[model samples]
Target: MAKRIIKAETVQITYREAIRKAICEAMHQDERVFLMGEDVGRYGGCYAVTKGLLKEFGPERIRDTPLSESGFTGAGIGAAIGGMRPIVELMTVNFSLLAMDQILNNAATIRHMSGNQFGVPLVIRMATGAGRQLAAQHSHSLEGWYAHIPGIKVLAPATLEDARGMLWTALDDPDPVLIFENVMLYNMEGELPANAGPVNIEKAAIRREGRDISLITYGGSLWKTLEAAEALAREGIKAEVIDLRTLRPLDDTTIIASVAKTRRAVIVDEGWRSGSLASEIVTRIVEQAFWRLDGPIARVCSEEVPIPYPQHLEQAAIPQAEKVVAAAKNLLSK
Candidate 1:
């Protein structure tokens, strides 16, 4: 079967702008939708993604909460149960650790616990990953941890289209959804159609196609994998790049098929080596596509450590284009 393509008339915009527009559009279209978080109103969001939205939507829709992640996140879950669609921003993934009780216990389990009568139609947005020298606490990628939960949907919007489109679809879902926005990608610019809207949150996307090897990744790592793909091309090695948009579902069909076609695989993730999402992807490929493999699967992941404060150490800790290229090259050699 031929690969699918998405065509749109797009204009250049930064990743931050695309996200801001998506929120603005969602609020304008649905009166039930409201945003609440630290610095969301008067302070214009921690990353300023909600800048100017307070004036347009007013204090009612754009609320600023205290530094209580557990409190506000729980409130958002309660509000969602009460039939209101709330977009709760937790500032950063590290801070979200405070709200894990509400997220993992309440938001994720309410529907099943209530026998399907209750659905937490909540959207939790948080900044994830490292690159800004924010040290171990402020910078970490925990989307993999969230993806471990069976009930909630985990999303990492790596591209402009995804940044602009995924939130609305997530809000419309009956269960809870967590959107992990890589802090490094806020300034990344790309062309997005003026009319771009909600996109399907079900399947993975093939960002770049090849037959020699498959480099699978998502979020901030997507760009690094793509860069590695390009570098590999120069050496006459063609690499297929698969972006796992919705991490929870895993999209085994797309991943298995790609590995089956290429006959080799390399999983890239920003999380640590042990119990990481990359480990899960590798396990899935081995389980489903074992017969198709021409060599052992490889992985490029962050070094097992609390991401360091120093620039050089931090760079070495996370997966990079060079690391991905080396992993893919090793796979092809065998």
Candidate 2:
């Protein structure tokens, strides 16, 4: 009898670097994986995540698409249907609306409409949330919009581990996955677990445990929620922070369990109050844990207005640390 040895491998890197690593590794693993978007090739991406990728992968796989969002978006869908794994970067989710037909109509509905004969193996990455003064047009949280679609998997990678690992999982999935990377979280540094490989796109992860309140949030708002939780700790308030990595297939079990213990929840979302992800989450709580509640559910969401350009006003427009704390306190009082 002969014995065979099996070995595991992994790497550690920053959030931005992790994204590049996953893309490069996935491309190396499969020839079908290709990237297309404005400035993704020659300019090295707007946020520099795909920097130097074009030089290594060449222009064919590392395509520099034109500014026509709708046209190139449709092209990406067509390429995906033609047996290619196309990663389309929309620059920002706000601009993705221009290509809604290509995404929602084609990429998201193809497999179901075809009677499960075909799967749209497409990955769409975009910078989302309100910050950096990009204002109303460039900065908007559209994850809810993508999550609303049936065939798409919407992911919000709030940590470096998920940032590196989710891409692989999303690419491997047999349907379209939208990866939203908050602009403020790109530079955040954290240790990547040695065994961190592919993360599930359908489950939520509890980042911190507490029994007083559940600070639920995802993407850019995660940091702010954590900050608010830290402050609450000083005043002897316990907060269980939940990082909702995926919005579409939301982990209701984790959320419901936390809310059941705390009997209170404050959802922090960087989107407008009305018709936002926060609203949907609150609704879920009402449906699942209405009897378990100790007080009325509360939400700390962005003001219902265009994101202001001024730094101070911009801070006021979105959910900040203080805002989250206040919301949590208000809920606790009720």
Candidate 3:
């Protein structure tokens, strides 16, 4: 019997499935690449994004580590420094905190500390964002926090193409790379071209073009921002939607260009508003493109509170299209 394989030839697929296919393709292409994490093997991963990979690749490569994020993540870093490509999966963004020292102190500083004598070609994937009523400890969008650091790249794949394409490109990078998959986007249905493969991890993509204002966002908040753009369009306001695909090395050119053109910007981020990626972008706009602005910049971010477990509270705490729309309108009025 001919072996059946995953394929996405202009067919509808979920964000989760696209990621699994990317892992499969990468493993097939590079013998040095391997996946390691809690429940990543027999348990098919915490979110099942690595399902069937264990059977296809075997235990040697599909390692299921104990509940020690720091231990496994450190091991993955060592493997990378030893010339092997390792994909370390931290079950949730919250859990990554356990490995902070390993990630920030070692993986992020190895090359610099060693004076370019070493490189950590490692990729760390984790589920992020507040949704599904996971409560404070289990949920939060901290990708923006990691973007604060230097020597590492941060990527947020908001669409099917990115879910399928960004992994390999990140793996190809010489330093550590972190990929944050919004938990809410796993079930999202989308299409990817059959030939879709590695995508650029260096710049932002303008999802929609407009002249009224720029709706800047990334990850789970991107969809809400896009919906707000559509709503604004119907109300005679053309809002450009910019998806900051790669959070770190933040594609400042794309953001400054969009804000300079629209003359207004509303940053919609699932992370907290205080000192967030949104704030960084806004500060950059003010510093670099202040003259192009026609109105004050606004931000629609998660309310300043630990994400609530109740569905209503959770939804209200995070950025929504309605909030984005209101912010845009208020900016336009100002």
Candidate 4:
């Protein structure tokens, strides 16, 4: 069969509105799909992404679970196994830790553990990254931790198109998928194709094409990297920005090709530096394109500290545009 088309004429909308549209479309297309999470029903989503979905889908489909992450998450897993496609929402990445048993132990291992007889066609959506001054407890970027797992698919939708399209694809996958939406991107407004639909979740997309250096990132860090690229352009340095939309699969092909062309790289990640997704990407670049490199790979990551509540400290704690520019410049100068 020919591949499905998900794009059409273009229109402008906010990032959160795109997400809400995606969920609404998915539910309308398939009755098997339903949404469950804290404040998802009458209260709307914690970030207000689901503000009007409750009335549209009703209490049955738009479930409002108690504040028990583990319990509701596990219930979602069970419901998935019973032939229902459930979208379970965790308020934040930090709060997702409470559901680790159900996610890591069960959702990520069920297919292999059950000899491929059982599949978890579930989607777990949660907010990630820092910028809201929610403190350490509420603002953690643990998408990297989920990416470390083997079976479950990890996705970070950084752009309006991905926000509008990824959910339907995730719902179609046989295995479990975790979508990490950067809380800061919710209000971001942009124009998207009116016919936008499910996009391929297996590859990275180069937001900007350049030859001097490759700035690789995903989710919240994407826009920052793009800004840094613009700054580098002003200084006569062209930088390529790659958005690794799928974290677990790590789209090594796109990453390697970019590094092979640019010959230098700077990874920007919102997670802490040590043993983070940025570290993993750097290692991959070294292993796959070491001979093509003109300089040592560098990374711009969050400082090794709990995200502080104070605005200045929190800004310091995470990767930003200036830091990415500096890292790229350093790589090019080397």
- Candidates in order have lDDT scores of 0.95, 0.89, 0.94, 0.95
lDDT of 4 by residue, 20-136 (tens): 999999999999999999999999899999999988989999999999999999999999999999999999999999999999999999999999999999999999999999998
The residue ranges of model 1 lying beyond 4 angstroms of the native Cα positions read: 1-9
Clashes of each: 0, 0, 0, 1
Each candidate structure's TM-score, on Cα atoms with residue i matched to residue i, is: 0.97, 0.94, 0.97, 0.97
Candidate 4 clashing pairs, residues 3+ apart or interchain: 9-194
- Model 2, residue 195: what's the lDDT? 68
* Candidate 1: C-alpha lDDT: 0.95
Q: lDDT at 83 for candidate 1?
A: 88
Query: For residues 1-334, what per-residue lDDT tens digits would candidate 2 score against the true structure?
Result: 7796764554556789888888998899999999999999999999999999988999999999889888988888888888999999989998899989989999889899999988888899999987799888988887887888899889999998899899999989888889999988878776676567787787888888899999999998888889999999998899999999999888999999999999999999887889988899999999999999999888898888898899899989989999889988887772
**Candidate 3, residues 226-312: lDDT per residue as tens digits?**
999999989999999999999998899999999889999999999999999999999999999999999799999999999999999
Model 3, residue pairs in steric clash: none
Candidate 2 residue pairs in clash (backbone atoms < 3 Å): none
Tens digits of per-residue lDDT, candidate 1, 16-43, equal 9999999999999999999999999999
